[model samples]
Each structure stands twice: as C-alpha cells, then as structure tokens.
Target chain A: MKKIKVFTNGLIKENPVLVLVLGTCPTLAMSVSVINAIAMGLAATAVLICSNAVISLLRKVIPDTVRIPCYIVVIAGFVTLVQMLMEAYLPDLYDMLGVYLALIVVNCIILGRAEMFANKHNVFESALDGLGMGFGFTLALLLMATVREVLGNASFAGMSIGFLQDYKIPILTAPPGGFLVFGCMIALVAYLTRGKAPIKKSFDCEGCPSAAFCRKEGKACGTAETEAK
Target chain B: METYKLLLKIIMTSVLVNNYVLNKFLGICPFLGVSKKIDQASGMGAAVIFVMLLATAATWPIQTYLLEPNGMGYLQTIVFILVIAALVQFVEIVLKKFLPSLHGSLGVYLPLITTNCAVLGVTINNITDGYNFLQSMVSSLGCGLGFLLAMVIFAGVRERMEEADPPKAFKGIPITLVAASIVSMAFYGFGGFVTSLFGE
Candidate 1:
C-alpha cells in the first residue's frame, strides 16, 4: 500500500547516497572495508530510525523557528548513545570508525530526513521512512565497499581472496579510489534509472535540504523550473 | 625556531597533503554542489573559511578544558555541533544586521555550513591531533584555505566540463565525481612532501 511505498522508496527510487547524494562524507570515508561499511550503515540506520520516531512525536511540540536545532540535538543524542554502546561492546569497530562515529552528528541524511519527512509525518510513517532511507544508505555503502574491498584489497568482508590478492589496485583503497568507485556507481545508477538519478544540475539547491532556508533564489537558474515542476 | 618549523609543516600538510575535501572527503557536499562557477565557488569557499576558523577556535578550548577534564569526551559530537549551529546562527544575524551586502551574497551558504562535515571535522581533528591552541588555529586556517583552493580549482574544471560532452548517464554528477577522482589523484602527489620536508 502507500505505507509500503514510503518504506521502499529509499531502497532504490530515492536512494539517499546515490540519487540524493546526501551524506557522501561518511559514505566515502567508511566504505573502505565491507565490515566497516556494514557497521557504519547499521549504526546510522539505528540513529535514523530512533531520531525519526522521536522527532515525529515531538514535531508539534518543537516550534518551527527552532526545529532544525531541536532535530540536531535529538539526532546527536542517539548518535552518542550508539557511540557509547559500540565503544563498550564493539571496541574494534569503534576504533575503526574513529572520528566518523562522532561525525555522524553532522551527517545530512539524518537531519535531512528529520526536516523533510519526520517533522511532518506520524511516528509510524516517520519510522518507516527512516528505516527505508537508512537501508538505502547502507545498501549504497555496501555496494561501494564491496567494489572497493574486492579490488583495492582483494578481499571479501575481511577474508583475502587467493589470486586477487596478488593483483590488488592500491589506489582503490585510497581517497581517489573512493571517489572513482562512488562516481561509477552514480553513473550506473543513472543508467539504470534512465537518467533520472537526480544528478547535479546547474541549480542544485532545488533538491537541497537547505533550499527552503536559502535566500539567494535568483542566482540558481533551475530553481524556477524546479518550482514549476 | 623549531616550533615555527613545526607550525609551517602543519600548515603545509593540512593544505595539500591532508586536504579535507580531496583527501579526507569532508565537505564534498558543497565541493560538488557549489563549484559550477568560479565566483560562486569562491563565495562558498570564503564562507567555509570564515565559519571553519570560528568553529575550530571555539571548539578547541571547549574540548581541551571542558570535555576532556570532565571525562565527557563522548559528548564531543553533540557539543561541537551545537557550537557550530549557534555560531552560524550568530554570524548570520550579525551579517544581516550590520553587513547586509556581504550577507546577501553569503547568507544562503551559512545555513549549509552548519551541517558541513568539514567544519565539524576540523574541530574534531584539532582535538584528536592533540594540537595546542596556536597549532589548532594554524591548522584550521590552513584547512580552510586548502578547501578554498580545491573549490576554486574544481570550479574552473567544472566550467570547462560544461562544454565537453560525455555519455548521457555520466553527464552531470557522475562525470563531475570522476573528474574529482582525477583531482584527488593529482593531490596524492603531495602526500609524501610533508614528511620529506621534515626529513622524518
């Protein structure tokens, strides 16, 4: 039904990392290994679901003027909760994620969902949307991590593949590799989606989460077209 | 003299070797979103530099004195973000009230900076790197300038990309990201320069 559509929307149609290009920083940073990517994805998903439900419940209580700050505080609270639990239980993953675990505070995906969906939807719907978006984000990360780990390190998960290990592309494990793999995935998604992957246009602010608050409207040429559509 | 040399090395390493965008992948949002034109790129760059410098300055002491001593390091993420959010809001208001013209140009980008990982990254990095106050300031300034440098260069390339045709699927962001990979590859050359300079 409509609920299912909302839940599945983030998996492919509106994939946060590929289509929306939200939260690219952590996506690139943590996708070097399959395990790291999965851990990061699950962590982010937990935060997203928790924050979304809470934000939805408090949507009416929080004033419009201070909603952004309120949502950030809520999201940060969840992130800290995750960080602590991970540090205590999964110390290795905790260290591996490093600064990025904390950087989740600024991950636009969480805040973006809070503003775009959670603040307006009911708790159940918001939770579903968050779950969908989080899964989409995690899926994209898994895809990138798979390619990167297989080629860069010649491994799957953490295990080494016999022959491939001898011919690993070191660059795939580096910064440039992250960008290359990410770029190609975006192209692949665009191709599969029939050139409707929300690629960068002249007026990128149109779909940007901050677009509503932006004041320089006349500058972006696509703003008018986007608005019309 | 030795301290000055170390500071110089920090600046060099941050600007080129450990660039926030190209190397660390921080702030790729604005790096891709606003780099279509030279002017807009520089405007965004300038705004980032201003905000980053302020955010780092504010967060460093808070981390050193407030967070660490109290064993509240886990609160670093929440605290730093709130600081940045408040700083951006304060800057926006001040700009609107006093410097309306400057605000008009940079105002739109200010809100975006609040969630910019680079701002938060630099603050967190300053602490984790164990830099003292002066070193943190230099590193923050260097990181900001490096971001500006990358944005300006990427802007020029994107301008040229407008004319060159690519495959339909690779036309917009995908092609741009590929180009960024090349840029990142070029930046990789500077990786060993810092260590060599220090002869370490």
Candidate 2:
C-alpha cells in the first residue's frame, strides 16, 4: 500500500514540476524537442535516484550545518559520474543534452529532494521518493515536450503523425513558444486539479505513529497542507 | 584593426542579431521579473551586466587552468555554479562592507543572480565558443548591454501597456509574453542587417 502510494504520488498527486513548481529552469529551457526533453529527464532521474539512495544511507554521518554543501558534493559526484559514463557510452544523447547535463547539479530538484527528504529518510523510503519524484519530473518534461514538439515540429516522438507534421505553428519551435505552451499546460493542470478532492499526500504522517519512518518518504509530507485545506 | 573588427562583431552580434534576451532567451527571468518598472529594469540590467562581466573574467581562468587539464571537464556545471554562487556571495559581502550605497541598490538582485541562467550561460558560452579571455570579456559585455537594451525597451512598452485595456486572460504575464513575441520578431530584422554589415 505504501509503495503504490509513493509511485502514484509522483505520477499525478505530488508531481515535482507541476505541483511543487521546482526545477522550472531546466524544464523551460531544454524541452525544445522530444529527444532533448527525454535525455534531460532521464539524466536528472538517474542522478536523483542514486544521490537520494546514497544520502539516505549516509544520513546519520553528515552534519546538519554542512548538509546542503554535502548533498551538493554527492550530487556533483554522481553528476560527474553520469556525465562521463554518458559521454563514453551514450555519446549521441551526450551531445544532445550537452551542457544541460552538467547543469543538472544545480537543478534544484535533486538538491531539493536531498535536503527535504533523502537526508532524513531511510534507504528504502528515500529510494522510493527519488523514483517517484524523478518520474514526476520526467512526466512533466514529456508533457511539455509533447506540446512543444507536436505544435512546433508537427510530430510526436519523432514520427510525423497526422496533419500535425505540416501543421507546424513555427512559433512553437522557437523560444517564446516554449514558454507559452508550458504556461498553458500548467494553467490547465492547476485549474483541473486545484479544487478536486486533493490526493492525501504522505508527509501528513507527522505526529502519527510512523512519523519517524515516513519522514524519510518526503512525498507524503508536501500534500499535507492541501489535505488539511 | 583586427581587434576593432572583433569588437565590432561582438557588439553587433550580441545586440540585435543574436540578442541574449529575444534571440537566445538567456536572462528572461529578470527580463520578466523586473521589467515592469523602467528604473528597476535598468537597475537589474546594469547589475546583470556587471556580474556577467566579472563572472566571465573569473570563470575563464578557472576553466582553462582547472577543468580542461585535469580531465574534470564533466565537473564544469557543478564547478561553475559553485564559483558563481560563491562570487555572488563575496560581492554581496564586499558591497555591504565597502560600497554600502551600491549594495543597497543592488542587494535585492544579488541573490537572484545566483540562479540567473544567463550568468552560467555566458560562462558556458565562453567554453563552447572557444573564446579566449579578452573575447569572452567582450562577448559578456555585449550580452549584458543587450540584456539592458531589451529590458529598457520592454519596460517602455510595458509602461504604455498599463494604460491600454487588455483581455482578462492575457492581462498580466500573457500579454507581456505576446509583447516579447513581437519584440522577438522585431529583433529578426537585425539579423540580416548585422550579417550584411559583418559580411559573415
């Protein structure tokens, strides 16, 4: 039950990009094409998952004063590791993502999770939070990419489908198009779900019997306010 | 004469032909954030230009000496961000201690520059464009001035926009975005002119 809740939280309820509004910089900049979006999303997810796991395991040892810097070092370490491995293995995706790959270290999402959840949680829960949040981010990227690529490039996932291929809006491919499309998507999501029976987020477990353990799983905590409202 | 041509090229490229805001979309956060007021727009622009120039100066040596030779190229993002963050902090402290007046003017924006992609973008631009120290400095200056130019111009437009009645849905950010689109199209006019002038 707990695991399923964690997984679904990232998909819809506590989506990192849409709900939390974290990591807008990369989400806005890199979603120019479907390929770039996926590559950026996957790279960030890999870093987030690994860093969260590692931070969870070492949560006890890292002092609070240096926690932010410590997480950065860990994140940067994995970022470098992922970057080199990508360059060596997936040279093509490496080229596409280019500098943005390294920019993931300041991505806010990874560091946000590290500070907010991973540093406090146990290994299992932290890993779940990472997966859920990572997937949530990827989902947002894909959503944005779908709009940008479909309207701008007139194709989805590289295939020239339907009348949309020739239906190129031209502006959608450019910079302003990225912002306009993203803004609309965000508005739609907010309008639709803002007033719905809000999904009970996990972080609400505070003062409950399992607060200690669930604290590690940060997903539940964020929606607590909404749940109360 | 060669240096003059490079300077001319940098100015032309950075201003209209490949504007940091309209064309490259580098510093749109502040562009959108602070451009509502003309005075604030220029203030933000000047601050950005100043920080950008200094950042280019600082990051160039760090890249040349540290990242390339050590094969820590992969660490570029993390290293550059840390350097920029630290630089912003240092500048804030120094301003508070020495240039209190200037600090008061720029303090609100100092913390904002840490995440401004344009700062990082310019440094990254130096690396990828293979710009040496001097050229990078020139490009940074050009980019900053271009940012200033865009902000000032947009502020002028927005000042006028306040008087005009607009649709409910597109009143605030939406209309500003539309105006940006128009400005972006206007910038496209500079492309051909700049290319012809440079003969590139």
Clashing pairs in 2: A121-A216, A201-A220, A202-A220, A202-A221, A203-A220, A203-A221
Best by lDDT: 1
Model 1 CA lDDT for position A22: 86
**Model 1: DockQ vs. true structure:** 0.57
Number of backbone collisions per candidate: 0, 6
- Name the lDDT value of residue A193 in candidate 1: 78
Question: Across residues B17-76, which tens digit of lDDT does each residue of candidate 1 receive?
Answer: 999999999999889887877887888888899998899889999988898999999898
CAPRI-wise, candidate 1 is medium
Deviation (Å) of A75 in candidate 1: 0.6
Alpha-carbon lDDT of model 2: 0.74
Q: Give the Cα-based TM-score of candidate 1 against the true structure.
A: 0.93
RMSD of each: 3.2, 7.6
